[model samples]
Target: MLSAIREIGRLVVEQVINPAQSSGGKIITIVLDEANAALQEVGIEDFDPEKANRYLHTDRGSKGNAPAPFAPLTEAKKTLNKIRTWLSGCEKVIPKTAADCDLVNTINRALGLDDPILKAVDAAAGLLQKKDRKFLTVKLEGGKTFLGDYEVFRKAVAYFADRKAEKSCSTGCACSICGKIQEKVSARTLVYGFDTDDKPGFIAGGFDKTQNWRNIPVCSECRTFLTQGRKFIDSRLNFKFYGLNHCLIPQLLVGNADVLEDIINILSDSHKSVSLRHRIKRRLTDDENEILEFLSGSKDNMTLNFLFLQKSKSAERITLLIEDVFPSRIRAIFEARDHVDSVFSETYNFGKIRTFFSKSDPEKRSNDLNKYFLEIVDAVFRGKWIDFSFLTRFHMDVIRRGLVKDEYFAFRVGSVNLTV
Candidate 1:
């Protein structure tokens, strides 16, 4: 798993650093929606100098409620202090371009401000009575202003990235994935599919004083690569099937862009064509064949993996249902689905089969629905026959639901007759 993640990270960095791509660093900044609202309250069409300065510098109290004059000022001071640290450190790492110089000057200017920016921050803190403090974002206008525009911010982020990569890892153990002896296997470098949650401990290991990132046994370079790869997959190669199942197709390519495009098209077609709304079920089999043909073109050389994830109720972590399935195996699994569809099609339409198997009632659906799907998927991939009892149960459910229409009922009866 560590190796796979590292490979993905390498791919991401390759794509990102590609001269054609426009990928860059990201920074967090506060959005002052309440301050804007406060300005608009006084029929100020355009922000006055004092209001604009205040809006740019400070945020509403952390809770969004109007607090004492010092509350927002304190927050503003914290943000400025962090920016100052970044500015000071960034000078050593980043080349001093004109924009970089301007950004540095802006930060220095804000730091030195006593009356307008700072004083307005205090006044804005006192005036804001609403509890609608906006989120910290890189997407807002004022935030962009604080960062001296997106291009400069991107440079700054790139500088930070370089600095982070150059830092030494603390752990000297050989990387489990690369088998390289190196220092600096920090957990801060590694990226997980989901955010680390300490409450239920979804991150899989303790991040305490005694046991740190050393437990993972991944080096800093590998960790950075994997993190980038995860981000790229999350942004680009991820998709949904049945709107309920989240799937990620991470491809290991040897510069075969055509094959990659074909795989993406195949997956997209499968997603669109196999839905319950689609009546011509046989088309799905054809689509599966198209995918199979694409996979076979590689002759088992290309590696394609799938990850199916489910979000936890608290939305803190994703529970993986299926991880790292090969494209060839996925093709076989779909072939099994095609076979199952054929068997049911003789009696009922494909839609009915889907309806029967798929969880329709969110309230009453078994928690084991994903487990059942995983079982079927595994069975299909392995070319093992689905248990006869499973079909028997489906037949029983159909009878109990009074869904046994004429031809369908006859087919069910014939199936039972053959089994008996």
Candidate 2:
């Protein structure tokens, strides 16, 4: 999944999708048009309402309660403080090269203001308060976000990419992703719900928190791609799966990135996905629309990866991973399901299978039995063997529970038939 994500990130960085546009969310952007002009003065009169644009800025990182590196705005004052701090850092780090001079001067002028860009931020916040908006961002009128700036991104990468040097380590360490020893590596796991930074015990080597970089060491390039890959996943591939959340990732088979790019485009567009499903006569359960429908008519050059995950706050727990499922296998799964439905002369699908495993509680939420049900799902998709006696045991349990008036007898019988 991490490798696939890195590939997606590579594609994103290669301009398959503009990283700036793709990383953005539903943000109320306060465009500081004429920054040079704004820096010349310090008053509300200098702020322009025309510069404000409300569009979707899908920064998934900020959607959670955790503080992101360049977090979106919750309060105007805090946003200004971040801006000030960022500018100060940029001034100190951005080289005086001809290529960087313009951005450096902009940062310098923005910070040089006696009142600075406070008025613009205050006015922008005031405008946001009048309407309902989930996030706020300040950008220059040239259409580049602060985080989207090339220099800012480069600085960020350098700061993180050279962590080995920062820690005063002269020797190279092995990177978990590429399996190579490198002088520079990062401790940050771009994918959340995987390895968390807060847990020291989760570290691979020792309990020394400062030396945690050795655990799942990722190189700078891989780390960058992971970041972009996560953005793509969060914004596009994440979907609902039988009352759970899953990420549908595509892995290339023929060494052709174009095929993977096509898959990405298809999944990202609803109309294309529906059209593909219809062309292939694919049937889907209600929850399966986002999961199986899009791959119905895809080529055999790539396989699909389904990662069912549970995320709470900052930690994520993977529920199940059904990997390397080829398009041919998907077709086989559906064909088998259809054949069963036809033989029974009744509706049969995964949804019905799920009911047999569903909790009898009032809310019918997930419980310990979910793992067993997921195992069944994994087995079905992978064409793995299931013990006949185990199925009989479960079926008998359902029947006996119904007979004892624990559940409706007819419903249990129907459920048993659907699975059998």
Best by lDDT: 2
Model 1 residue 27 distance off true place after TM-score fit, in angstroms: 12
Model 2 scores a TM of 0.75
Clashing pairs in 1: 9-225, 169-183, 169-184, 170-184
lDDT of 1 at 403: 57
lDDT of 2 by residue, 155-268 (tens): 643553354323422237877776778876657555565766567676555776556677667777777678778877877788765666777889998866777887787776
Q: Output candidate 2 Cα RMSD.
A: 5.6
Count of residue pairs whose backbone atoms collide, per candidate: 4, 9
Question: Which pairs of residues collide in candidate 2?
Answer: 24-58, 25-56, 25-57, 25-58, 26-56, 26-57, 26-58, 27-57, 193-316
- Tally clashing residue pairs in candidate 1: 4
lDDT of each: 0.44, 0.62
Q: Model 2, residue 320: what's the lDDT?
A: 93
**TM-score against truth, every candidate:** 0.53, 0.75
Give the CA lDDT, 0 to 100, for residue 162 in model 2. 55
Q: How does model 1 fare in lDDT?
A: 0.44
